[model samples]
Target: MTGLLAFTVLVALVGLERVAELVVSVRNAAWSKARGGIESGQGHFPFMVVLHTGLLVGALVEAWVRRPDVAPVLAWSMLALVLASQALRWWCIASLGRRWNTRVIVVPGLPPVVSGPYRLVRHPNYVAVVVEGVALPLVHAAWTTALVFTVLNAGLLAVRIRAEDAALETLPRSTEVEHA
Candidate 1:
């Protein structure tokens, strides 16, 4: 019905968004590697991939099967959150620019980014991920997917952030650079 169509469109959009992220990640990863980037947290990366893929698949399956009544308030609110999440995600990406990759590969001499959302948060991208994982599902009343993805993503982020921090610890911090 109409709900299914809406859910399908949402999932399609999310899938497209992920494809774009991968495109950017691949390019940036190569850029970083060319500049002597060393990758950490490689072990958990596959799981992270699977988990994210599951977020989309699970959301679609649950929303279709459960057919939960969409409370306009919850749906609209969560929709807004989903939109905000994408904005925050792109902000993190734009902030990092050539330095942003999905993987935690750090270039030794390069400065830690202190621009955009980085000024406020150590891992603003992860914040976007967490919010999107929860809010995207809730947009169509897929509470099960939201809860599961949130918990799993939390564990993943803990490992990811730790590995990233460990890697960063070996490098010297540079003063923030002003961008136009």
Candidate 2:
């Protein structure tokens, strides 16, 4: 019973985080659009939203139905991962600033961001997302949710990353022209 309540609270917190992200995404989307941003991979965006929403809902439902015993070791490790993923996600958002949007909107003249986590991984935000997809459910012993979301998110990301790369293909050339 106590575990169930705790898991419920965790889901609520994650939902809140999703709300906050949406606020940022909306603001950033507007900023990008005002600057002639061209959106790419529009079709996959809806699936991404559904997948994230399903993660939150599925975690709660799975925990309630399965009521699996939580191993302290697993829980602790997953908690660490969840925290790390959140930090990385926010870092990506801050690094991109007004240029960040939930959609892949490429503003032709803007330079690609190579700072923050992006310095190491081209898609650091997606890395955080993948980590969170697994960690969040495992924290509550929802292995099924974690596995399903990870697999589905993987497919979506394959499409998303390709679109993003195509959108940013000319960034280097544009940057060079500006500096020349």
lDDT of 2 by residue, 47-84 (tens): 99999999999999999999999998987898899889
Candidate 1 clashes between residue pairs 3 or more apart in a chain or in different chains? none
Quote model 1's TM-score: 0.96
lDDT of residue 66 for candidate 2 = 91
Query: Which portions of model 1 miss their true places by more than 4 Å?
Result: 178-180
- For each candidate, what is the lDDT? 0.90, 0.87
The per-residue C-alpha lDDT of model 1 at residue 41 equals 88
Q: Pick the candidate with the highest TM-score.
A: 1
Q: Which regions of candidate 2 fall more than 4 Å away from where they truly are?
A: 173-180
RMSD of 1: 1.6
Predicted structure 1: lDDT: 0.90
Cα-based lDDT at residue 74, candidate 1: 90
